[model samples]
Target: MADGEPPKPPPRLEESVKQSQLSPQILYSDVVKAHSQPYSQQPFELNTIFDAESSALKEISTYQGKPSVVFPFSDKQVLVEKLKYVLVGKFSHGRPPMDTIKKFFVSLKLKGDCNSTIFDKKHIFIECVCKEDYYHIWLKLKWFIDGYAMRVFKWSPDFSPMKESSIAPVWIRVECLPLYLFDEMSLLSISNSIGRPISVDPRNINRTMLHSSRICVELDVDKPLLDAILISFKDEVSKNILEKFWVKVFYDEVPLFCSFCCHIGHGTGTCKRRLEDIRSGQGKAEILSADKVFDNMPQAENSTNSTKFVAGNCGSKMGKQIRPSMEWQPIGKHVPNARSDLDNKVAPE
Candidate 1:
């Protein structure tokens, strides 16, 4: 293709997407192989350097004529005494507390959630701004707000199974939209991803004009991973709107490895429970079987636990099956066994 020319369909758009050339794709092995520095047993020059660096940071952040440090000393408030002089002393020595700096952040309502007493003491408000990086900053800021809400506003924790609590969003996008854009199949997958609070709104359009159709996701999770996942998901959604429209997702931070181990990561086979299916002589490993009954089971909804055995409804369906035994005895039908009639072993001895 000439300069300014977009490349033609390379026969397999899905494969092309899997090989996206843009960002660094650090694999699990890569992270595991990185070198880590050992902790020192004794105080070294590095401690001095860190102290000096902290001092410099405080120097740049001074707030008032009193030489109030931008960063407070490790401790600013006292267990029992007027603390202003101690803070002043630390600021004089350029050793404002890192803990106090965090307090300052909360006071400014810069952290997640908004109702913490510190925020009350500091006072702040929430606002939305549209800009180049609005989406990214918005996700981060939401988490901070949500955190504040939980701690100070008395909102429930994000992951806890509680109503009235604030929550992180779960970002979801299927890259195979070109193949199954608005089908029930993809919608169910999206629902599985939204987790507890958020809901899914599917795209309604016929196949002929699906290219012009668009899919929108509103979730409560973190941003960066959501954005990264969306990039990969572009290959999944086959809508025409995606041809020129940039795909984006932003939600709260969800740990990639933990989610992966919980069977929320890529491809179903690597899931531990999925592996158990193979060990138990279930059907072979499958990506999308025509009759993936387990996948369709209502019990499978939004479950992070994959270790549980998937016991199917054998012939009698859900009711318990009675085991046949030659020694079977109906309730109060038979006399006690000879062993029960006999005295204890010590009594016999």
Candidate 2:
């Protein structure tokens, strides 16, 4: 029966067309009339949409003039207290992935779990599960991740991404110290005069090295570093008399410290504070003395003498005159009138 007849249309398509034809149509004139009506007489649907948009715009305008809410000090204190075991670290060369950092710390066999997250896009914020883990990670000072050096710093409530830490733990060697003053208490006393003493080096504790005692101390870069310390002690031969000794202090691998700005990471030549002072006619830039400049230069090795020469500061290739080494007095020798004139020595301009 279907062979000679035409096929019928699909039921859904035919029904859809019938339904469309049955629906009422709005003329172009009717649409124009509706839009031409006053806002009060507009259709409910159109009024509702416009009213919602207007309300949103008004809310945004009101917010534009409102002041930002100030963060309470109590809340900040609570937050910082909770993050006591947190540390902030940043690579000097490259920014490694979070997993790479986590795995690297884990490989060290830390006492507790350490979690790391990207901080300020350039730095890494690490949270340790325990205080032991926190000190273990932080006390190392510097870490190498795939040969890239990462500098770790303690996290504080006032930590800023724009500024580098001014306080750093540095290993300082106290040379010319008497052999009798090699104990922990004596070393700590000497170290305290320099900065906040963290710990005495293992070799110093064991008395393996007698030439100098090494100690890790937390130094504030904003303060002037003491190049030498003056110690007064009772004479071994004459207990009633006091004698003075100068202990030479040597800072190892210290970054560029600005004497003008009293900050680390920059030299006096590039000090912004000095530039501002000069520009404002408040004061002239302070030139570092020869002694201060030489303090920063590496000591040249020599068999005859420990002498330092300034080459470029005088615009001469031959270099300045060699500085003579200080004459160190023997510890046991008693000279009742022996006095320390080392403090009176002045550097030539």
Model 2, position 152, has a per-residue lDDT of 82
Candidate 2: pairs in clash? none
Q: Which ten residues in a row have the lowest lDDT in candidate 1?
A: 83-92
lDDT of 1 by residue, 85-170 (tens): 11000111132234544454456533243221222232222221222222233233223332232111112213222221222333
Candidate 1, residue 80: Cα displacement in angstroms equals: 42
Give per-candidate clash totals.
41, 0
The list of candidate 1 runs beyond 4 A from truth reads 1-119, 129-136, 141-165, 173-349
Q: Which runs of model 2 end up more than 4 angstroms from their true locations?
A: 1-85, 92-94, 129-136, 139-142, 146-149, 232-245, 257-349
Q: How many residue pairs clash in model 2?
A: 0
Superposed by TM-score, candidate 2 places the C-alpha of residue 29 at a distance from the truth, in angstroms, of 41
Task: Identify the candidate with maximal TM-score.
Answer: 2
Top-scoring candidate (lDDT): 2
